[model samples]
Each structure stands twice: as C-alpha cells, then as structure tokens.
Target: MDINLSLRHLRAFVAVADCGGYSAASRQVNLAQSALSRTIKEIEDELAVSLFDRTTRRVSLTAAGEQLLLNAREAIASFDGAFLRFQHYREGLSGTVSLAALSSVASILLPPVIFEFQSLRPNVRVSLEDGFAGEVVDSVMQGRVDFGITSLPRKKGRLICEKIAADTLTCICSSRHRFASKRSIEWRDIEGEDFVSFALSSSIFEVVEQGLRSADVSLGNITKARDIGTVAGLVSSDLGISVVPSLVLPMMQFCEYRGMPLSNPVVERNIYLIYDPETPMPPASTFLMDLLRRGPRSKFKIPNGVRWIDYPDGSCQANSN
Candidate 1:
C-alpha cells in the first residue's frame, strides 16, 4: 500500500491520540475541532482501519493506532536528530574541510594555523593534501579540494586568486662557499657559477629562470633535480648552488647550507589563496579561508624573508616592507 502521509498528518494524529479527545487535541495543536476531526478521519480512511473508538466524552486508540503511534514517534525523533546535526554543520561546528597546498607551504606555513583552527572548531576535520603548485591549482579547479595555497602566479581566469604572502628568492649554497660570508649576494655575483637548477617542470624553476633573466644574469647549469632534498644533498656535496624561495630553507636545514638574500632587482615569489568563486564551500571550509585571509603574521611568527600581503577590500596590496 502506498502510504502517502505528511509529518503534519502524523503530528495531528499523535496530538489527538495524546490528548484523548478532539476538543483538547484541537486546543493543543491550534486547530478547530472540526479540522482536527477531519485530519483524524483522513488518516483512518487511508489506512482502512478504525484508529480510534469514539465516545461521547473521550476517544480510545485501537490496536492499529497503538502500533502506528510507536513508529510515527520514532520517525519524527530520527528526523529531528538528523536536522540538528545538519544545523551544527551549517554553523561550522562540525564538518570536514579539505585543502591542498605546496609541500613547502603545507609543512612550514600551515601547521600553526591548522592547530589554531582545530582549537576553535574541534569537531571540524581538516584534510590537507601536499603537492606541487600545478597540482594545488588542479585540486581547486576540479573541486577536489575546497581551496589551495600556492606560489604559482595566477594563470586561470576561472579561479579567484588572492595574494596572501610573498617570499624572496635566496641563493642557497654550501656554508663553506665564499658567498656565505656576505650578508647578501646580488644576482650578478652568481654569474658563471656552477648552478644546480630545479627540474623544468618545477614551479620554482620557472620563477628562478624569469628572475635570472630579468636581472640579466646567467649561470652554468650543472644539474637538474626535482626534489628539494635532492637539491639540498647536491648543494651540500659542493656540487653547485641553487636559488629558491626563502620559505624552502627550513626543509634544507639538516644539510650544511646558507641562504643569502638575492638582490639586483629582487624577485619575490607571491603566495596565493585560490578557489573557484562559483563553487559554494562548506561552512568549515569558509571559516578556514577567513582565518587564512586574516594574514598569518597577525596570529603566528612567520619566517624572516617572507612577508604577508595585505588583503583589504578584496584587492591585493603588498604589506609594508
């Protein structure tokens, strides 16, 4: 049998059954006695059973009504509980936020922020995916993640990119290298030096290449490495020096290397928060994005060579140097 009934119908039935008479039930449910009688009649007719034995002064439930009462109460309670949980999710009290970021960012910049976010919304789970800049962008575009953090320059019009921070490129070399004695090294200082270049596919490679080209300097490319650890290993072995964003220095700390600030038309790699403006994020995701947009420098101690960008009125502006 097709049981086409609404919650209102069940509520009316329950109210009538609980109150024991139409006059009282009508008062409790805020309906006229006539309307309450009609609602009870509709339920009885649909089920093809006498749900209540009508008396002059009171009504008593039949066996079928007794059975339905149990099930109806359970169904309503279940629905109410589910709705309460949904409300919590909507309020950002509980839900999952998935995010992607560059490996350097995931390791260095995000830990303290994630810790603070979890403290505020303990029930909200944060899932972080670490990858290259291109992978981070792809995750946001494909809806694989709620948002992404990357140093890759904005190339996609579909994405709404906001610059969150900038890290200066630094010349990384062995501690024993002559460049380490200097406070900072100009781009021309590394000209004709044996250089360990990042692989062509690396996002850092493109930035370094552009910066070098802009400064009118060239290096004798000795080797190409894809992994930061590999580059560190090569440089520590006195193979050659390489230029990377200052944020990358911490990862190479175990190796004996010094990061000297690179100048002569200083190149700053801009970090961006990227998301598809068309997609609606979950409450937890939106909350995390807001925390990030507030600028990490306000909440945590950032590295020396990195600067947070000011995001006011949805426009990108550099923070005071």
Candidate 2:
C-alpha cells in the first residue's frame, strides 16, 4: 500500500470523527464545509475504506474510521508537541548557552545580567568559565565557549569583537602609599616605585607596557601575577602599587585600597564581547550577546560607590573628574 496521506488529511479526518459531522468540524478547523468534506473524502479514497456513514440527519464513524481515529489523534498531538518544542528553543526560552570571560568580568559584571536572564528564562541554562583574557579568547576560538568577555585581543583575524564598555585603568595601592591619598596620579610619579603587574600573556600587561613606554617610564622591581585576585592581594598588603581596570575593584576581595585614575595619556581598556563570526550563535547566546552589547553598566544597575565614567564617542579621554 502506498500511504500517500498528508497531515491535513489526518487532521480533517480526526476533526470529522470527533465533531460527528462535516459542518461542525469545518467550523472547528476553520475550513469551509465543502473543503472539509473533500479532505475527509481524500483520506478515505487513499486508504480505500469508508470512514463515515452519512445521512441527511446525522453522521457516524465506521469501524475503519474508529481505528484510524486513535492513530490520527496521536499523530496530530505529536506534530503539535514537536512544533511547540522548537518554538521554545527558537525564542531562547529553553536551551544552553556557554560563555568564557576574565575572572574579574565574570565575578563582578555578569551577576546582574545572568540573574535577570535566568529570571526571564528559567528553563534556559547558562554556563560560565573564568580565566585570563588570552585563555578566554582561546576558549571562544576553539569552540569551547560560545563567546567571551575580555579586553580586545591583539590579533583580530577570524574573530568578531564588539566593544561593550569603557574601563579605565586605575592605580591601586594601600592607604600607606603616598599617592594613595591623591585623587589622580601620573605615570611618571610611579616610574621608580615598586609595581605589581599581571603576567606577560595577559591583556592588562600589554596595555601597561604600552602606556609606560609612551610616557618614557619603566616599571621598577616588578612582581607578576597570573590572576587579578593575587594582584589585588599584593596591592592591599602594600607590597607594591599596581595599575588595573577600575571595573575590577568590585570583584576583588581586598579592602582599604584606593583607586586613582592614571594621567598623562590615561590608559583605558574597552571591554569586548568576542565570538567566532563563522559559526552561528545559539538563540539564547545571541540574546545574551545583544544584552551585553547595549552596555552592561547602562542597561543594568551598577553597584553603589562606583561612578560611571562616560567616554564620549570617538574620543579616548579617560582622566578622572
């Protein structure tokens, strides 16, 4: 037997069986009475069986029709269920999105965004990994994570990077440091001072190196750390003063440390959302990426005691007011 019946035929057959008449099922299926009757006839013709006993007053299902009714209802239900499942996935209400970011950005910046996203899409799962900027970029490039949040990479080949926010570099030191009480300090002032810096592979290290070179200053007795938490710990203990992104202050566990903006070609790093443009991002990940692109600090509530430094578009002014 060549089973050449379509879903429309099954739906009309089920409706006619349930409604017990062509006119009632026609209204239920939003089809004209004639069209509905023809659909039922097509299914019966294809199956080579009489499915309905019709008269001027009433209509009844035949034995063949009764047997098909069970299977027809099941088939229609399965089709509808499958369509709904796909719709949920397309709308980002369900599925998983994985992302990688610097530890500071993950701990301080992602909480509000993730919380809000979870509240709206409780069924959608979000997984996050934290590391240095280089590691984060590697994860996204290797397809380990869908996207990454970090400082813009030095190499931009085969990747799409979008700036999310302006983060100014700040001088972090214990209260005992002389410049600690100053609202702003110049790079020259810290040229001869002991400096705690990030690992050479980290993006922050590159930025610091370039800024110092531009100002004709060199780091003295440098202490390098692989993680920002360790850098914060060293600074809080008054081991040495370090330059770091102002946004990292909130995520660091240290207390009693002051943040002063760097002057004389003030160094500011723009945080970027990086992903591979070749592969399509998942619907849930795309939604989160859009949220991040809108400027996380502006779209979401910022923590207290931290002021937002608005960088005018197309300008690089990062001096603290």
Considering every candidate listed, which one attains the maximal lDDT?
A: 1
Expressed as tens digits, the lDDT of each residue in 58-129 for candidate 1 is 999999999999988998888889999899999998999999998888999888789889999999999999
Which segments of model 1 are wrong by more than 4 Å? 18-28, 53-60, 313-321
lDDT of each: 0.86, 0.81
**Which regions of candidate 2 fall more than 4 Å away from where they truly are?**
30-35, 45-50, 62-64, 296-299, 303-321
Q: What is the RMSD, in Å, between candidate 1 and the native fold over all Cα?
A: 4.0
- Tens digits of per-residue lDDT for model 2 on 259-282? 887889887776777888787788
By summed lDDT, the worst window of 10 consecutive residues in model 2 runs over 312-321
The residue-level lDDT of candidate 1 at 251 comes to: 91
Give the TM-score (vs. native) of candidate 2: 0.84
Can you give the lDDT of residue 240 in candidate 1? 93
Q: CA RMSD for every model?
A: 4.0, 4.8
